[model samples]
Target: MADGTVKRQIAAKVRQAFAPLRLEVVDDSERHRGHSGYREGGESHFRLTVVSDVFSGKRRVERHRLVNSVLAEELAGPVHALNITALAPEEDSA
Candidate 1:
């Protein structure tokens, strides 16, 4: 898939999987330009900030696991790195 398509797919998958109160997906690959694993082709690194009720009472590791599980196919294939910031709705500052 093209970079834009991949990004949209990631966003849509996250929204569908978590039903978050808030979700933001940022393309951070530009900052890593020329670095190892950096894709000159397009953005590959991402930062995902998500707040969801599903994260309530869940430990950090568990929350990461849940997100990873939801994006398993993408992670295993297209997405090279994901910087995930997960929070419960009540814990969200925004």
Candidate 2:
């Protein structure tokens, strides 16, 4: 699939899986243009900021593991780097 399409799919999957109060998936490949591992079509690097009730009691390591599990296939293939900022709903407001 195309890079943007893959990114959108990843976003949709995360939204569905977490049902977060806020979820932002940014494609950060553009900023790395001409750099190693930078793809011309994008979707190489991503920053995911997700705030959800599901993360309320989870530890930081667990939260990241959950997200990593959700995108396991992608991480093994197309997704180069992922910066995850997971927050509980209560933490989100503060």
Candidate 3:
């Protein structure tokens, strides 16, 4: 996948799965240049913050698992790292 396409795919998949009230998908591959798993094009690393009711009663690990499951294909291929900040709407406000 190309740099921009990977990010868009991730955001779209997350949005479809969680229907988050707020979501941000940031490509951090540029910062990982020269590091292991870094690719010529950016899209290998990402930071994701998602707020939704689906995470309201879930544990942190569970929330991450949900996101990971949704992006399993990407993670297995082009994406090297995913830093997720999953939150409920109330937690986001806090």
lDDT of 2 at 42: 87
lDDT of each: 0.85, 0.86, 0.93
Residues 1-94 of candidate 1: C-alpha lDDT, one tens digit per residue:
3348778888899899899899998888788788766777655788899999999999999999999999888788767889999999889988
- Give lDDT: candidate 2, residue 56: 89
Taking every candidate in turn, the Cα RMSD to the unseen true structure, in Å, is 1.4, 1.8, 1.3
The C-alpha stretches of model 3 lying farther than 4 A from their native spots are 1-3
Clashing pairs in 2: none
Q: How many residue-pair clashes does candidate 3 contain?
A: 0
What digit string (tens of lDDT, one per residue) describes model 2 on residues 56-92?
8999999999999998988888778889999998898
TM-scores for all predictions: 0.91, 0.89, 0.95
Reference-based lDDT, residue 64, model 2:
97
Per-prediction count of colliding residue pairs? 0, 0, 0
Give me the displacement of residue 29 in model 1, in angstroms.
0.6
Q: Flag regions of model 2 displaced more than 4 Å.
A: 1-3
